[model samples]
Each structure stands twice: as structure tokens, then as C-alpha cells.
Target chain A: MPFVSIRLAGTATKDQKSAIVADVTQSLVTRLGKNPAAVQIVIEEVSPENYGAGGQLLADRDAPKPQEDAHAESSQ
Target chain B: MPFVSIRLAGTATKDQKSAIVADVTQSLVTRLGKNPAAVQIVIEEVSPENYGAGGQLLADRDAPKPQEDAHAESSQ
Candidate 1:
């Protein structure tokens, strides 16, 4: 049996969660030959303030304008 | 940064959760030298019916009398 835990930065719609569960279950079944009924998936939505990466809180990182991706691509 | 996700079979009290967070944070800080401020811990309490081990649901397994542990010990 495999228990999968997914942590997201924010809340997800019911439909989105359902899709994720289905996709994760299918992947485990296909790759590991695990029983679909035995697969468990728990999705945890944490506030941005509680989630951090690279020593910066997600809330602070997201607060800035969404220009970093474009700036990086342009520089490349 | 270390993100710790704990999956429990059922709900935990706020105090219990706080203790767990503190313990986990301390462990990471001591062992990995991670910053306490950068550590994120999410506790996911899932229903027994959703968790399975050895192809049996935790709900069903827990429904039986808790004598199995004693029986195994006695046998040993």
C-alpha cells in the first residue's frame, strides 16, 4: 500500500483535487502495479506564509510582481 | 529549508500538533542545520477508511478487537 501526500501552496477546487487523486492513483497502479483501491492520497493546502523555499516565504515571494519568469527568459 | 508532512490516521489535538511541530523542527534544526523559521510542517489527519496497509483498510482493521497484538506476543 502506498500513501501519497501532496502539499500545495494554496487551496484547490474539488474538481482539481479529484483529478489529482485519480491521476496519482493511476500512476501508482501503472508503475508499481499497486491496487487502485489501496492507494491513499492526502492533499494538504498550506497558506503561503507557512510555505517557504530557498529561505524565503512563499507569501513574500509571491507578493512581488509576476515578472521574474519573463525577466529570466528575456535574459536567456 | 525542510518541509515535513505528517499523515495521521485521525485528528490530533492542537497541543499535540504543536508538540509534534516543535519536535520535528528541533530535530531538523539539530541534524540538518536548517533554520527554524524556514521549516514548514503540515499535519494531515486522514480518515481511517482512506488509509490502507497490506490491502486492508485501517477502518476495517481497527474495527476488530485489539487482541491481535496480544495474540502475536503470546505466540512469540
Candidate 2:
């Protein structure tokens, strides 16, 4: 049995999740010759506040959007 | 930065999840010398229906409680 777990920021839609499950299962089946029925996939959605990348919280990094700031300044 | 993702059957409580995150972080800190703040842990809970082990669905395995059935038979 092969179990695959995916963790990402909580922004994926239901369709995206389905696709991930299918793709991961397919990879295991094709590469490792695992039975499709025995392949399990779980996707965990983490809030930006709970996710840290490169020693910085995703929430903090997402708060200051440089592109948005530039756009606001140009529109002013 | 170390990211750890755990996938398990969906039976764990909030306290269990907290302990898992703390322990995983501590392990990374002790073994890999990674910054505690930079260690990210994500726990994904999968329903028995979606979890497969030994080529059988967990839901199916859980349905037949052999011990419980034996006890029921003994009481009859």
C-alpha cells in the first residue's frame, strides 16, 4: 500500500484536490507498479498563518503584496 | 526549513495533533539542527473509506470487528 500526503496553503478548490488525488495515485501505479486500489492520498490544507516557509509565516509574507501596493500607488 | 507531513486514519484528537507537531519539531531540531520556528508540520486525517492498507480499504477492515463478534457469540 502506498500512501501519499500533500500539504499546501488552503487555496485549492475541490476540483484541484480531485486532480491531485488522481495524479498521485497514477504516479505510484505507473512508477512503482502499485495497485491503484491500494494507493491512498490525503490532502491537507493549512492556513497561511499556520504555514511557514523559509523561516517566514506565509500569512506575514502574503500580507504585504508588492504588486498590489504598486498598483494602488499608480492609481492614486 | 523542514516540512513534515503526516497522513493517518481520521481518529486523532486535537491534543494528539498538537503533540505530534511538537515532537516532530523537536526531532528536527535535535537531529537536523533545524530552527524550531522553521519546522512546519502538517497532519492530514483520512477517512477509513479513503484509506487503504494491505490492498483492503480500512473501512472494510473496520467493519468486521472479530473480537466484538466473538464476544457477542460467547454471550449468546
Candidate 3:
């Protein structure tokens, strides 16, 4: 069974999660022979304000969104 | 965004899957204050052949053990 579960928002590097469980258990033990202790890799890490993208967060995705019609035509 | 990925062997009832999405999403929204749509629940179903536990396939999980001193001999 290919049990590769990697949920990420932060915190990787225990050699980048053992190189993603040794490159997905050596690609399922060299193209599906399997049985490297049945290959179970689970990594779940989170906390960039609980994670988001495009819709923002990750510290407001590098800030700078104050257009507001160029400050309302420079305060009229 | 709590994306709950469910990879199970064979198919589950469609209602079953949507239930998983709803349950986890609602749990996130209700408890953790998350956006419902941002909770991506990915379902990846596999065939019995590609899945194994206790060094055996799903087809084999239900069948009788030939006195191999069963570890978790029931979960169908």
C-alpha cells in the first residue's frame, strides 16, 4: 500500500522529511515491488496562520494591497 | 484550509464520500474557523491489488488467515 500522506504549511527538514520517505519509498521499491516495511509516510505540518493562498494569509501574501482607487484620487 | 484527503481501496458510496467532505469541513468551520470552500477534500481510490496491510491485499483481508497468528484480523 502506498501510504504517503504529506500535509504541509510549514516545518520540513529532517533532511526534508527523510527526502519524502526516500523518494516515496524508492518509487514503491523500484517500480512497484514494494515492501520496504510496507512504506507508510505521514507528515502533517501547519501554521502560516493556519494556511491560505490567493485568497491571502501567509502574512497577507507579502502585503501591499492598498490601492483603493489610488487613495481615492489622492484624497480628492 | 483543512484539506482532508481520503484514499481508500475500491469505491465507497458517493454519499459516503460527500459525508467525509462535509464532516471534516464542518468540523473545521465550526471548530477551527475555516472557510468551507477552502477545505479541499481529495478522494483517491485505489484497487485492492495496489493496497495491502499486514502484508496482504484487501481481497485477502477478509479471507481466513491460515493460522498466521492474526494481528488485526477484522476491518471489513
Candidate 4:
């Protein structure tokens, strides 16, 4: 059984979820000759606060800065 | 570095999530001798409607049914 788990940075519409499941199933069927019905896919939407990169939480990294000048100074 | 993704059929409390992350990280460290700090675990709580098995959506399978007799009749 091919169990595919997909993690998205944010939420997705029901349509998007449906399309992903279908697309993934099709890929497995086409490439691996797997049974579409047997393919299980799970889509996970992660909150920015819970996911981190570059040693910074995404929520913090994407948050608005105080001022353009201050931000530029901090980056330097 | 190990990235672990866990998909649960339903939601979990924040405390439970924290424990799960810690437990998973510890497991990797103990078994594979990976650094606990380098272990990344994402816990996904999936809606029953979005998960399917045995050719039926979990939502439908877990939904409240009609009278007991009617349900028994349909299963046969």
C-alpha cells in the first residue's frame, strides 16, 4: 500500500484537497502501476506558528516588521 | 535530521501534541541515535470526512445511523 502524506504550509480548499488526492492516485497508478483504490493520501495543513525554518518560526519570520529602516538595519 | 509526519484520524489537545513531538523525537534519538534537536515531527489531525478506508469515508462510517434494525438490515 502506497500511503502518501502531504504537508501544506497553510490551509487548502476542499477542491484543492480533492484534486491532490486524485492527482496523487493517478501518479501512483501511472508510474508504479499501483491500484488507485489502494492508494491512501493524507493532506496536512500546518499553521505558520507550528512550522519553523532557518531557526525561525514561520509565523515570526513572516510577521510585519516595525519599520523599513529598522528592518534594514537589523538585517545588516 | 529526521522529519516525521503523523496523521491522526481526529484532533488532539495541545498537551497531547507536545507529548507526541517529544516522544517521537526521543524515539529517534534512542533507536537511530539521531540528535533530538534535529528531529522534526508534524502532527496532522484529519477530519473524518477527509479520510477514507474500506471503500468508505470515515465520516460516513462513523456517522450516527438510523434505528438499530435498519442498520443491521443494511449491513447484511
Candidate 5:
């Protein structure tokens, strides 16, 4: 089985996480030709003080942006 | 939306990815309380030769094993 591990850094709204999981799973089913029943998705939430970027923790950065931009590329 | 990006190293069987996506998505909805529709999962497949481990490319590893072991832990 192609077990996909998604290490999401930064806190996300409950609804937001759900939306991500559902659509992402669908993408895998259609784009990769995987069965909808076997797909696995993992979402981890990290604190701004915990995740770092550009050499600084997100909490320390002037703009503590989450890594949501990676998926900002809408497949829609 | 929380965009979950899963970079899968090595080719995966169609059944495997499907199982992983489905189960994982359920876990997120149950554990993180995210909406199924809003969640977005992306699985990028990499050739075994394209992935690396312990400083050696998977294609060059003496064992040449895929990184699917990370999710070997079954939450089922």
C-alpha cells in the first residue's frame, strides 16, 4: 500500500483540516488512480514557535505564515 | 484550508495508495475534526532511484527499500 505521510506544520482550524483531508484524498484517488477506500492521510499540527522557516521559527518571523501555500495551487 | 502534501518515495501499488488515502482521511476527520470536503491531500510519487536514505539514494541503497515504512504503523 502507498502509505502517504503528511507532516503539516502549524495549527489549522478543525474545519480547515477536514477540508484538506477530504479533497487531498480525492486528488490521490483521481490523479494517482488509487482506490478511494485504501488511501491514508496524516495531518500534524505544529505551533508557530515549533515550526521554523527561512532560518527562524514561524512565531519569531515577522510574518508567521503556515506552509499552506504548498497546496495553494488549486487543482480546481 | 490545510493542504496536506504527501511526498511518497518509490512507486506504490494502486491498491496501496488507495487504502492509505481513505483510511488516513478518516483518521483526520475523526481525530482532528476537519471537514472531509475541505481537506486536500496530495501524493507525489517518486522513483525508488529518486529517493534516498542514510545518505544513499534508494536506487543506490544496498537494500533499495521504499520509504513506506514510515506509515507501517497501522492505526487500525
Candidate 6:
């Protein structure tokens, strides 16, 4: 059995998910000559809070800087 | 640190998830001598509609058979 796991930093629409499953299945079929029937794929949408990259959580990395927020407030 | 990702075809209960995390953590610790605290496990559940097998979506494969439905309707 060929199992594929995809972890996304954020969510995807149902259409996107469907397309991904189809594409991955096709790729495996083309490359390995594997049966599409035996290919299994799981798409995981991970929240930034739970995903870490570059030694820090994605949420912290992507969050607006405090100074930037203060600047915006001051400008307003 | 060892990271493990598990994909399930359907949903799991909280107790099942907790047990799985604990079991996997222990396995890494026993086999690889990795620290339990450093072991990170992510469990992903995929709906049948988003999963494909036998060259078709699982949802489609498991759907009610047209012949069965027709027989039921005729009997009714």
C-alpha cells in the first residue's frame, strides 16, 4: 500500500483537497506504475499554533509585531 | 527528537488518540532511546469523501449500491 501524507500550514477548500488527491494519485500511477486503487492520501491542515518551523512556532513567526501594531495605533 | 505522523482513514476517539500518542512515544523511547518529552506525534484523520482507494473515492466506493436501492424501492 502506498500512503501519502501532506501537512499544510493552513486550511484548504474542499475543491482543493479533491484536486490534490487526484493529482497525487496520478503522479504515483505515472511514476511507479502503481495502481491508483492502492494509493492512499491524507491531507492535514495544521493550525499555525500547532506547527513549528525554523525553531519557532508558525503562529509566532506570522503574528504581527507588537511594534507594528503600536505604530498603526499611533498613526490612527 | 523524533517526530511521528499517523494518518487514520476515519475519526478516532480522544481516549484512542491519547493511547496512541503514549504508545508511540514509548516505542521511540524504548527502541531509539529518545526522550519521551522530545517525541512529538501528530495524528490526522481523513474523511472518506477526501480519501481515495480502488481508483475511486472511498465515499463513492462505500456509497449505497444503486441496485440495492432500486430493489428496496421496488419492494416498498
Pick the TM-score winner: 6
Question: Which of the CAPRI classes, incorrect, acceptable, medium or high, describes model 3?
Answer: incorrect
Itemize residue pairs with steric clashes in candidate 6: A37-B54, A37-B55
Q: lDDT winner between 1 and 2, please give it.
A: 1
Q: Against the true structure, what is each candidate's TM-score?
A: 0.48, 0.49, 0.50, 0.53, 0.44, 0.60
Candidate 1 stretches with Cα past 4 Å from truth are: A64-76, B1-43, B47-76
**Span of ten consecutive residues with least summed lDDT in model 5 chain A:** A1-10
* lDDT string, candidate 6, B1-36, tens digits: 788888777799999999999999998999989989
Q: In order, what fnat does every candidate score?
A: 0.11, 0.18, 0.00, 0.07, 0.19, 0.47
**By DockQ thresholds, what CAPRI class is model 5?**
incorrect
What does candidate 5's lDDT look like per residue over A1-76, in tens digits? 2455555556767777677667766766665676766566676777767766668886787564555764575543
DockQ of each: 0.09, 0.12, 0.03, 0.13, 0.12, 0.41
Off by over 4 Å in 3: A1-43, A47-52, A55-57, A60-76, B63-76
Candidate that scores best on DockQ: 6
How displaced is residue B52 in candidate 2, in Å?
A: 0.9
Calculate candidate 4's fnat. 0.07
Give model 5's clash tally. Answer: 27
User: Cα deviation of A4 in candidate 2 (Å)?
Assistant: 13
Candidate 6 Cα misplacement greater than 4 A, ranges:
A5-23, A44-76, B67-76
Candidate closest to the true structure, highest lDDT: 6
Give lDDT tens digits, candidate 1, residues B12-57. 9999999999999999999989999999998978765554444344
Encode model 4's per-residue lDDT on B1-76: one tens digit a residue: 8999888887999999999898888889999999888888988788865664433445655877769978899899
Q: Write the per-residue lDDT of candidate 2 for residues A2-73, one digit (tens) a residue.
A: 877777886799999999898888888899899999898888688665554544445655776689888999
Winner on DockQ between 2 and 3 is 2
lDDT of 4 by residue, A1-76 (tens): 8887777787877666666676777778889898766877776688999989999999999988779878899899
Candidate by candidate, in order, the iRMS in Å equals: 5.7, 4.9, 10.2, 3.6, 7.2, 2.0
Stretches off by above 4 angstroms in model 4 are A67-76, B1-45, B49-76
